[model samples]
Target chain A: MNRTTTEKVVKSLKQRHRKEKLFKAAGFASVCFGFLLVLTLISDIVIKATPAFHQHWLKLEIDYQQEWLGVDSLDYEKLESADYRKVLRRSILAMMPEVSGRQDKRSLYKLVSNNAEFTVRDALLKSPEFIGKKKNVWVMLDDDVDSYLKENTEFSQTGIRISEKQAGWIEQWYNNGLIDKQWNTEFLTSGDSREPELAGVRGALTGTMWTMLVTLILSFPLGVAAALYLEEFAPSNRFTDFIEVNINNLAAVPSIVFGLLGLAVIINLFGMPRSTPLVGGVVLTLMTLPTIIIASRASIKAVPPSIREAALGLGASKMQVAFGHVLPLAMPGIITGTIIGMAQALGETAPLLMIGMVAFIVDVPMGVTDASTVMPVQIYLWADSPERAFLAKTSAAILVLLTFLMMMNTLAATLRRKFEKRF
Target chain B: MKKLPIILSLIATSSNLMAAGRDTISVVGSSTVYPFSTVVAERFGKTTDFKTPKIESTGTGGGMKLFCAGAGIDTPDMSNASRRIKKSELEMCEKNGVKEVTEVLVGYDGIVIANSKATKQMEITRKEIFLALAKQVPATDGSEKLVDNPYKTWNEINPDLPKTKIEVLGPPPTSGTRDAFAELVLEGGCEQFAWIKAIKKQDKNKYKAICHSVREDHVYIEAGENDNLIVQKLTTNPKALGVFGFSFLDQNSDTLQGSIVDGEKPTFEGIADGSYPVSRPLYFYVKNAHVGKVPGIKEFLEEFTSEASMGEEGYLTDKGLIPLGEAKLKKIRDQVLSFTPLKL
Candidate 1:
């Protein structure tokens, strides 16, 4: 009511307003920093990986001379063992007649991949009609040449991977329109290789699919049953409480420990095959069981008690009431939780490595029992490779893995938003 | 709850279907020796009726530990090693009842100091490299007292060198290549200090710690087992150098250049003929107990030691293995065929 008191109150109010403004700005800055960090990480992976999706190719004419190939007939066996390497060399020499001597010839051959002969042989074997004929085919270029075309390094570097002569040849080919860039579909469709350019995620991808399938098949029924019995049927006694606490604790165990368990119990004790998707799946099933059970129980608990009472009041038994009414109501949440758990299992590497899935398998697995690796393990292998080209391949693998995780997460979010009931 | 019984039955049926067998050979050891063993295993699998050997790239120390664990069907049949087994490891094997073991000498590998091709080639001496990388160096004024490394740039060690910063990306202490580098390059240079050489006579362990320890400064980074990362990092920072195997240098010669150490380049011939100073022989130890029990152990060893595999013009050489001379190769091959146990 006094003038001095009124002045004091106004000053305090002004200071409080300034403080609130500062807090708001700080909160905004922190959020922006977190968002910027994610953006930088994603963009860094994308920019580095974009080159891996597009591989370079060189168009060349092959004479396929019988004498040069050491094959007089079109027998598949003879063709497979034929000296296609010599024919390939002669073809490259024919293209650049000016290049001479052993060293120069070797440099000229370096423009094409060491696997070119195999490619040419495979193409011929598939079509015996092409034998003894001059054919123009687009062959995959060497990894170094591919890197050069992608401008991964400067053009005029003297001592870098690309020599001056090789650079000049590439420049001439570019001008002549003999160089081509195409989507690297093989990266998606083939298996792993010692050569970076030839390596693909097909084996790892299939292995992951099989492993996840096994995990889902094993964990889903077992997890749901456990949850249903505990939440709906089992009495809340000391034993039930002990089981609930242990499940929560198990969920917190590091994934690598599960790997050690799989190594010891699954592979060593049970005498199961190591490095197979079967073992990887079994290990992942154990890892994801706690998560799935916890989620299923939460969802089962979310269902209103009124629904169960209503079903029971309609003369249905306890099993019908729980399975018919309560289970249907909790379906959406259960599915979403399962998806998230599956995603977590999909990105696991250490446990699989412990089970010996780190083997360099070059064949796409045809069955769960076959030797296989998962996507994360493939990334680990490539990331550890000493080849420079594998650097881009590793980033590309990360991009692919991130996309898969995002897709799964998005699906879970959509399921929850579309079907989850508030009440 | 009804689903529980069905799942349990399914697991029981699957477990019944799976059986135990030890028909295949199991190999474990140094990552450096993994590729060669894998190649031999692949070839053996194709040419013979035997199953391809299962190989794991556990480090040399870890491999020796596993190899010496025992000599049973469950134990690994062989272990690839970048370094010779120590007396302690042999004694551990003996204590564990792994009495008979055969040591097969594979070819050699050269550890290389390389940089991105964009930089000028550096011809460095062992003493200069020691001063640049060692944790401690003799005081620069030629006193006998040891002091923390004070040089920040390559030129500080030798004025004739370039003024570029002393940045090196290398393997951690666990790597066998790191051990070879410390032994050959660091010790080779440490001996140039007469006082340090005399210290070795009085106390070998202290002398080793003094010579082998690298600086903890940011100038020397410990890149883990991923050598490709070092190559990629070098490309981005042209002034930085990397330490890796000669095979990596051979594969990425277009983008990288090996530095001249002790006036010799890390060429295959130089390494094979003993001109290259930082080279070491690679080996693999076979458990004689498993040789008869495990299928294809002896056959795989025979395939590996054949002239076609270990010869100068062998497939392993194409993969960057420096082959021994014909006379030495024959001697080692004869010894391996006879199953001569290593006398440790």
Candidate 2:
């Protein structure tokens, strides 16, 4: 009301503005720093995981001598039974002339897998004609050899660890060009195994894909239909409200509980096969259903009431009004939510762990009931494996799962962008 | 933040305790060894006025990782393993500045294939067991092939065995039981099959190709880590067999009979006498560095592996194990008590 008071207020306002400006600048710097920290973390993850993707190769060109196979005699049993590995080892030694004179043949066998002889035996069995004939071959030593070469499994630790002799042999082999660890893309292409040496991600990736596919297939239609009924078709009453509350509660329920429910309802009562991806998918569906329904209903509610009124005014049937108009309009949100829900299901290890989806998945699954492992389960199993080197494989799997999420998010964004133009 | 004053007092007390040449010793390792060690620690602690040793159930690998995690001040004082600490893992321990680790082979783990005692015919064979559990069998080309339903529909891989649906409840990979099972049963036998080794080489896939390609109708169920769940499921389902450790079976054998593997029925007499074949050794690895730092550890370890810990009627056997016989027990006790360092 007075000039002096007005002057004081203006001065105070200016001071407040300067303080706010300082705080805002600090806030921006803090946010940027936080993002940088995340970037560093992500970079570390990428760097750590990249090594797992590119395996070291011990490519050896073994002479598959023809005469050793006894192919000329036409004796399949005799040819298969003969020790083809001796010729192959001789051939590998022949190829690498520098590594000779250091060790006996028996000692060389221990340098690689105890089963390397078996590998050679298998190759001979597959194509016995190659025996006694010179042919180039590439073989991977077990993961331990890889780790030993890569320096992940250090030899210098004083304890009952890797033998001094084994470590020395690995070094000698590397120096003499007898073994070279190379990036094996086959690791990614193959499936998980009990042997750490032969393990891959194929079983897990496909399991996640099939599980998510089944989840999407079952959850999307049923969820959207339920959402439509609840939001538009159902009578507004206490029962509906109760049902809605329960659905929300179901959404909040721990996923493991759903696994138990699936065990009782789907596996026990309905006779669905246990440990099947179908059962896993069904369990995930129950875990994800409420999420999809809630999102679909929200999207439906978001649509302007005028569109429905206009459709009715044009003599559209109730079904047409709901499905032909409202449903189409709510499609984007439904897709996004459904995908997000599926992604949520994708990362879930606990429910599947309970549902028996974490079984040792050897080959890729071909059907719904096929016993298979998902990516997270694969990561868990690999992490828990006795070999210390699978620690890298675990991170690599996390990278793949994160990539899946990124892909789903990209799809959601593209759909959202496409749908926004229509509205 | 809430315990500023309390923490200050605690720090002061710790400093005073440090001045007195004593500190709280943290011992974390195997759940299997936890029982034996905790009992020893409690008795030793009470007698000597030293603190009771701490233990954690983390499976063998996890316990080793924690024990060897070179966060020097935060490292565990000891590690326990149901199986031998793998060579690669021992390297990891050494790399992490855990210089001196004393590996003690405490006793044998007679891994019993447990089922509800109410069931009849509580014996299974190595051949039957192989047919029932092996991931691969003979397909074409004498190679290992996958059997999807190992015991789902029929009991007999051979005509001699009775036909019954095969359903097994077992521990997840997280448990020591699973480790022992994979090693003692799967590895020891699976590799023995001429057909299996071939397929394992050719396919190179883990268990998928091994698990799939079987009858859609045949039976196998993947039970998780909870031994209790398996026990419960076995009681309810007559077709089911539960695979668990010996301690659990010995504790609950009143209601469960040990399934004979390859006709060798699991029993105290059988195991101690080496007639039972499925049993494995139990082990504990103490951080040799912490011997003096931790009060009463050397004495406790000494007491743990004495004839008192694993005699014919030792403390461990009293709890729920079949104790080793005289000569074997003496050998094992000498090995553990002497603190002989392992070499690969």
Candidate 3:
């Protein structure tokens, strides 16, 4: 080789290495940028959510006077129908004897939650022995008090929801060690409430469970059967091509169109109940079916035809070969597809909005036919609520939802790894 | 495959149970009135033995469609509206076998035009607001012709106003807040022009079209139903203004300030007393046919109209609901109690 040719080759090699180095650097930078963005988002949500996990409780001495409760005896019926709100008000007011004006008394009574009366009533019902006895109880503080305490513990400045007098009272309570922070168990146990502090995601969680159960049961078998027919049995013809193209197109259609279709057909035509998980699941099934079918068909196509030939050579019929060999091989991929589809359905709020699931339902739905709202809708509602504490609640709910999605994806990955056959 | 049949049968049975009859009262209505109604529903549920009513926050028109669909167990028992039922809607209800409905006058909701606390509170007149936000304004040449809104900034409309771009974030035309604002503020200001006032006598539709159309320019942004987002945006952009229900302003008072419209500040007392001009009455109509069919319809009405829920010192007040006046409350209570069919 000539010296000039060798020099030329060396020069090109250096330039090619430089270009290659630059490309790799660019790729690494993009990946790092993506990670940084996700990290910032998750950290911001976590910081906002941490405040919602703990709630403030005010310690108060409550004299459970049978007379105050308007119950002559500790009869269950009388206790059930008692005016516990009055007793709670009297106990809170007894703490601040100096407050006598109507407005001052109102602010003082606002220290505890309006729902705290149920706590007192339940305690009385559990222990009839406490009647006419002064017991020290840790009453739940109002959402405003909890928010103010969490935001401005020093009470140097008044809060948006907390007035100056309310701040002062909270400070007094804090200094006297009457205020304590406890895990917000109500946020997990109870149903939705108008009060931000009392609101819980149990109802939404169960609604999601029921809806997902319905989606799984309906979409899985239907999707797998269609995929199997197309991949193994259907002759390659114009009809099959049309079905294939339409399935792909349906997979690309916006989810809200399915919601409109559900509204028109399911609720309007079929006379289905509105705002029920049954309707929501049915709508989501329509939205998910195409994706599941496409994925399952691809997975089934990836199965080796040699296996099918071998099964047929062993005197097995076509049906037995497809079901026994191809299906077992494609099961892992099909499940992964279904999980992804379920995740998509789990995050959907628009389709549910059309069918009245974007509601303020207070009761935890007992069945699929009962009216319910899902987790995403609950987050949307909390974000739109007028209360200041709901901001943290919204972030907390998002955190819960993100955790749920992660767990589902992890389950899908684990199942894939366990069942995936390399051959 | 066996599991599939079991699931299908389960769904069929559950749906059959739901279709048989609904025991709980179902309420659908305006998002504007949802907060107040939900509070009342929750209170009623806790205080009584009846199941909690399911309330959907469909817009007023959507709620009316559902409420007036028919008289049956499948239809909603009550429809809440931020405005009175239109004559056409009443006719449709009558046509659909909903021969009778009792309209309960819920309290009022005030719409406020607010800005960030960083900026001074806006003292705006209806005419000035109309001139700033309307797609077409009266000609500045003192003629009876309409011209494109040429004023680019607040100071151009009025010299005393701040020298900032006239960017107003507000709800879309679909929102009840937008409806009330167009009717009360825009029309109120649009009528001040002598020629336009004369036009109202000639062609009511022309007057309404002129007055109701908000500007399509970038100055007027159709912020979605999320008022909290608007509040957040206003804090970041100090010069911008937002229109929303009074409850949002009350909740975010630390960062937002309500504008003074027509010399009256958007305060609770001012709005409740009718001094604030941009307030609208919220209403809920009950299907008289479902009064006895639904187990808790009558009891729920009584609880909603009770003094503790709708009174001056009621819990609703704490949630930013302005209570009705004494005489109006009494009249509404009597109407709710007697279930007198609405004449309209």
Q: What is the C-alpha lDDT of each candidate?
A: 0.84, 0.67, 0.91
Residue lDDT tens for model 1, A241-332:
99999999999999999999998898778768777788999999998999989999999999988888888888999999888888878978
**What's model 2's lDDT at B318?**
46
Q: Where's the lowest-lDDT run of ten residues in candidate 3 chain B? A: B1-10
Candidate 3: DockQ? Answer: 0.78
Q: How close is chain B to the truth by TM-score, in each candidate?
A: 0.95, 0.82, 0.97
In candidate 1, which residue pairs clash? A160-B254, A160-B255, A161-B254, A161-B255
Best by DockQ: 3
TM-score of 3: 0.98
Residue-wise C-alpha lDDT for candidate 2, range B1-344, written one tens digit per residue: 46546644653453344334324455555655554554455444433445545444456776787778773544567777878888888888778887667777777777777666566665566545655665555442444444343354333565554466676677665677766776667655555666655667677675334422222332445576545456557778866677876765654544567777777888777887777878877788877777776676777776676775567555466445566567876776676566666678
User: What ranking emerges by lDDT with the best candidate at the front?
Assistant: 3, 1, 2
* lDDT of model 2, residue A259: 80
Model 3: per-residue lDDT, tens digit, B1-344? 66778878888889889878887789998998899999999888888999998888989999999889998788999999999999999999999999999999889899999999899999999999999999999888888899999989999989999999999999999999999999999999999988899998899999999998999989999999888888888999999999999999999888999999999999999999999999999999999999888899999999899888898888998999999977889889998889999986
Per-model TM values vs. the true structure: 0.83, 0.54, 0.98
TM-score of the first chain in candidate 2 relative to the native first chain: 0.86
Once superposed on the true structure, which residue ranges of model 3 sit more than 4 Å away at CA?
A1-10, B1-9
Error of 3 at B143 (Å): 1.4
Worst 10 residues of 1 chain A by lDDT: A152-161
* DockQ by candidate, in order: 0.31, 0.01, 0.78
